[model samples]
Target: MRSKIEQIRMSKKNTADSGIDIIESPEALASQISRAEIFFIKYKKALIGVAIAIVAIVLAFAAYRFYIDSQESTAQSALSNVVYAMENDSLSQALNGSGGNEGLLAIADNYPGTDASNLAHLYAGIALIKQGKFDDAIDHLKSFSSSDLLVQGRAYALTGDAYMEKNQPEEAISYYKKAADYKSNEFFTPVYLMKLGIAQEKAKQPKDAIASYGKIIEEYPLSAEVTNAKKYKGLLEGEVGE
Candidate 1:
């Protein structure tokens, strides 16, 4: 039975003769393809329009990217100059545009979409604060946003300082708390905590102020502010003997 089945399968395979064959005549295939081309030619204008549209979109995107790059470069250059002036304590020059050169304010105004522009806003706010323009400083500082915890903390602290200078103790305390809570690391954290405690004291919240100071003494005992924090905490506690 197995032999008969094998012989029958071989006879079927011989009859079918399964093998791929290539077209021997190229001209015949070309003519067939040419007939298909004539059908495609009917929609040639539509296809060309789509291709042109795609090319135009690609070119437009490229041009937009180039414009953004140029703007970023210009903004960065302006920011560097402003930073130099700021570092040298030339607050006026850093805020206001120098002769033929844009300042931080100008970069923030002209290149609103760039990172440099955002940083310029921060610089401008700091410069304005230094110049005793608290309202203007708050305006610029609030407009600036940053994901970096350190920079964000600084911005919040500057805003708090401006509020305190303006005699708005509540707003100052709010910002001080934000700065104190943000990214509770060793460096800025203790300083902001001291500021927060002082602000709380100013706000007439002695208990809260004591708590803030105690937090500094407990968590950041080695910080520079710890000594002051301990003093303030003791004073607030009003413990006479021990």
Candidate 2:
């Protein structure tokens, strides 16, 4: 009984013996090798074209990354100045065009695709609201987006303020509620709840307002809003009874 490996070897030997040698001589083998070489040489340009295409794709990607980095850096530099002005409460310098430097508004306008520009939209909206441009503030704030919990919460709160300023109590209450609920934290939650309660009250939803105030009283007893929440709760209960 032959081993498996020996059987495979003997089978291959028998197959080879049964086959006719088409290219028996060294010269014929050389000719066959030369034909293979000719075929490769004929398609050499196509292979080189593929290689060039690959190289071009890599270079194009590198160039795209470089462009993106440059744009981001430029946006960051411009945004930093706007943020400084905003921090200093220089609302005009922060929102309007600041001569050659470009304020938050301009950066948000000119570089719509960048992260810095997106943040600029948010800051610009806040500045517009502070400057009493409620309509413009709403436009900018609506365009702004952020993944950060605090920033998103602040934007929602600011939107509520803008709506409140525009005499849109219903919209204000909705935004205030959103701010209070989004990523609720001990720091901003109580403040947002207070704003929500106030907005709800202004919107003539006394029951909802009472609920918001009760939430503050129950969840954030140590908050400054807690005293006001309890007082408002009592007032709302009295109103309901009458």
Candidate 3:
């Protein structure tokens, strides 16, 4: 029923339509990859440099940490003799080198970044405080840091004590407040509050002093500071009324 020429024309049309999908243009594909290839070639050296810098920084940090750990171990070993001297009340020997052994000062100096060095600062500062060398005590105490709430608060309080010894009531009041508020535990809080109240009284702030004492009575009644707090508060109240 169909003509031969008409069937041949139909076959040719079908073949032409399918050919468009079957074939891809080489120019279009090359254009897509050209930008990416150029970018990588242009920045290759800089990329490698950045990678090397990053690795160096990481390795340097690891080495620094390893050095600090080693120093801490050495410092701890050196500090044991100083502790024994301190316990025996050889305060001078605890600060300086005792006999052939290293003291707190030497340990702190030799191992500056270690935890044991920081601890040595605390002990040396307290020993200086015992010797009535308030300025030296403050210097060492200021250099000290601690994660323990009790010890850190005590350091703050002792710094306040140094200020008090210098008759600097305003400065003393500030540090006493820091100690009282640092961690707010049952033991040191009441004691620090007592010191704060005394400092407030010296600063001629009877109202503030009384309030500080009242905290001891209310919050830490079981503490030894409670008795002194009551006594001081009553005395101050009587004076304020007058």
**What lDDT would each prediction earn against the true structure?**
0.87, 0.87, 0.90
lDDT of 3 by residue, 32-144 (tens): 57877889789999988999999999999999999999988889989987888899889989999767889888998899898999999999989999999999999999999
The reply for model 1, stretches above 4 Å from the true place, is: 1-65, 239-242
**lDDT winner, 2 or 3:** 3
Candidate 2, pairs of clashing residues: none
TM-score of 1: 0.72
Q: TM-score of each candidate?
A: 0.72, 0.73, 0.83
Top candidate (lDDT): 3
Q: Give the per-residue lDDT digits (tens) of candidate 1, residues 1-242.
A: 56988999987876555321114456656777888899789989998999999999999999988888899998898787777789999988887878788988888889977889899889989889989999999999999998896999999999999998998888999998989888888999889889888888888888888889999998998899998999988988884323
Q: What is the lDDT of residue 235 in candidate 2?
A: 93
Per-candidate Cα RMSD to the true structure, in Å, reads: 6.7, 6.4, 8.9
Pairs in steric clash, model 1: none
- lDDT at position 34, candidate 3: 88
**Candidate 3: stretches off by over 4 Å:** 1-34
Can you write out model 2's per-residue Cα lDDT over 1-242, one digit (the tens) per residue?
98999999998987785443435666657777899899989999998999999999999999988887788899999988777788899999887747688888888988767888898889889888888999999999989888797999899999999998888989998888888888998899999999888888888899998999999989988888899899999999999993
TM match of model 3 to true structure: 0.83
Best by TM-score: 3
Q: Rank all candidate structures by their lDDT, best first, as comma-separated numbers.
A: 3, 2, 1
